[model samples]
Target: MNASEGLWSHLTGGALFWLTLTLVVYTIVDRLSLLARRNPLANPVLHSVWVIGTILVVSGTPYETYFDGAYFIHFLLGPATVALALPLYENRRVVLRSLVPIVAALAVGSAATIGSVIVCAAIFDLPAMITISSLPKSATSGVAMGISQSVGGDASLTAIIVVATGIAGAVMATPLLNFLRITDRRARGFALGLAAHGVGTARAFQVHPLTGTFAGVGMSLNGLLTAVLVPLAASLIGG
Candidate 1:
């Protein structure tokens, strides 16, 4: 093989290559997002997904191969999620003060999200599996997947739907909040996290620390609530 071809093959054969590529792509996209003044439309995760997806497709790399190299990053997700507790703890006073409203919002938001999915699925006559899979779409992917499986839904499909839901929520949140003239950061962050999960929490962090903390609170609480609610909702919907 030619030197260039040899080098390319060597690079793709190792775990470091995919891991580095993922990090570099995310870093570059994140920098671009900053350059864009942190515009909601310039969401780093959304753009990074597109870029990495295109690269994988163009290079004809199988997802299993890429994931083999990038699994370390996936492993970090657990720690990263746990780390959210730091912010929540740091803002304990604010969070405690808002406990009543937070609980109220979580209940209403979780119900609305699941109920709407069921209603739309029934209206469109979607399959039982698809409807059940969608019930946890508003939760974080790992939690959502478990909820989907427990409810006899497709876990993999639930992950995809969760990501889609998060991206859509992140992209729309800022503009929608601005349109509504909702100036309260707490409300905005909580709403974003409730609807969008982790992606929305990340977006909230970009705006303000307090916002991020509240978003994290919203996301965590919603996950727990969804875990309990989805199965009951699934049974009612005949999942």
Candidate 2:
């Protein structure tokens, strides 16, 4: 009993603490999202980020120290990303058949995402750096950060905007989709992944496996497409 207690203390009081806390909190948030029918406003990733970030700030924990533990989960992000290939490969037939729509959605979605942000920022007379950073708000966080840095924008602001965009997309897309009568799982999933990124994909998974798989493909493909296109567009627009 004493040894067990000591071991628990060693871990929870050490580098595993933050990691454990994050997983536990996220698990709870995920369950809540599930109960709430995977609504975007209650997105697990968004909630987890906000909740965890607040705890870190209020507790005055240095991000670096917390990262020591958090890095384990962070490292798994790459492997999890790679794992999306499983669903994509399994659904290759569906993907091949829908190639035209997929391509069209990516092109239009990416352009609209970038265009709308830039235009809104311009109308509001936001700073060039802010407008540039906001350009990738629809992309996944990792890709958005890269785009922000490449275009001389604020990476931190980009992260915040990306999260907000994802939460909003995840929340709003479902109703819009239902209204549009787009019941095709592939289309639904693809749209979610394209517009909302990871959070949308997560929501898609909760709805159905077929949706999840296509969402994974959309998320991965869109990331690659945006990473390449945004920089060129930025340069042309003088961002």
Candidate 3:
């Protein structure tokens, strides 16, 4: 028992410390990126992930061992997601008024996003697993990976694709909205969230308080719906 405790402390003491140390690196790099007029679409999370991921690979540490200690930080994600509801509740009146439009947008946007990705994959002759993994690219990583895994796709690939799609969406959502003359803040927020997931929600928050609230709603709702839809869609396509 004592030996096991010592081993745990030894492994986690330095590598597990990476999570905390990464935050400082993230903050400094984020500020520098912003000062250099870097695009917010190039989020600090993305950069920090690359840096930390490389470090993990080089150190030859196993993920399960590291995760044992880092899982506490991940636990906060649920609460953070729940807190988004507060902003939505504060904007309840506007949300109620726009419920129909929001639902309509979600359906159309969801279908378009899914259909186009599947079609593009078909045209490119991408592998079946790759196509399946890409289907949920617009949803949150946790939900998207589950959706992919349920359909026999690669969860790691799903995460990568989801992150890439989100970064692309976050970087382009505003410009795309402008080009399409999507001037309504609610619409922009909803579109951003539906298409970009967390990164888009973050971008929406920068636009306005109300926009951020709507984006959070859209992100959560789309995640729920996509979790249901992507599997069904994949089955149908395979059939």
Candidate 4:
């Protein structure tokens, strides 16, 4: 409406604010990665997202406008998810042999993921949105957001929590696994991805390609299961 607002919006690509920030942040993260020690916790995607989010908040840019530009990046998520199939194929025999355990683990893990969040929220008397947001922290962003929304959570918050949880899992999984004496590649991979999603899969790849393959398998399947289960779980709880 005002000249300052008009000029700022125009210069900022109006609704595409998030897109510009995403690119800029990603570029910075890429350079930093090359110029420093390669740390899994310093993940480019996670770091870029944080930088972009911080700037948007500081600038008072509405999340809706930022999401407009950010939505373009989301389109790639579908293809990237599908591409995980290649890794899965590379480990097909092991996958088949371990299908039962994987499914069982995923089922129990999914329940734990949602249950722990909900129980903690109840114990702390957290608001409904925060409680629901944590329910999908172990899922991929797209599926997690859907599940969050279905359960009366704010999808954007769910996205942030999902990313944060994945990063934390990626960072700590190796040491934790070692402590637990869980050295089997397939089991480690499955557990990490089931609990941590994409970041865990990326960390798994750092150790071995086979581990990455199984991690990818766990991440993709769990995402699907979480999407369906979250809503159903909410309904049952509410009922």
User: TM-score for every candidate vs. truth?
Assistant: 0.94, 0.86, 0.85, 0.85
lDDT for each residue of candidate 2 in 82-119, tens digit (9 for 90 to 100):
88888888889989999998999888887887788778
In model 3, state the lDDT of residue 230.
Answer: 92
**Regions more than 4 Å wrong, model 3:** 1-15, 33-38, 58-69
Measured by TM-score, the strongest candidate is 1
Q: Candidate 1 vs candidate 2: which has greater lDDT? A: 1
RMSD of each: 1.5, 4.0, 4.1, 3.0
Q: For candidate 1, lDDT tens digit of each residue in 13-94?
A: 7888999999999999999999999998999989988899899999988888888888898777667778889999999999
Model 2 clash pairs? 40-171
Superposed by TM-score, candidate 1 places the C-alpha of residue 29 at a distance from the truth, in angstroms, of: 0.4
Best by lDDT: 1
Return the TM-score for candidate 1, rounded to 2 decimals.
0.94
Candidate 1 regions with alpha-carbon error over 4 angstroms: 1-3
Candidate 2 Cα misplacement greater than 4 A, ranges: 1-14, 37-40
lDDT of 4 by residue, 1-239 (tens): 99998887786755455577678788889678656654666667678767877887888877777777778988786788788998888779989999899899888988888888878888999987687677888987777888888788898898888888888888788889999999899889988898888878977887788788888988998998888878876776566
Ranking by lDDT: 1, 2, 3, 4
| Model 3, position 159: C-alpha lDDT score | 82
Each model's lDDT: 0.90, 0.83, 0.82, 0.82
Question: lDDT of model 1 at residue 63?
Answer: 84
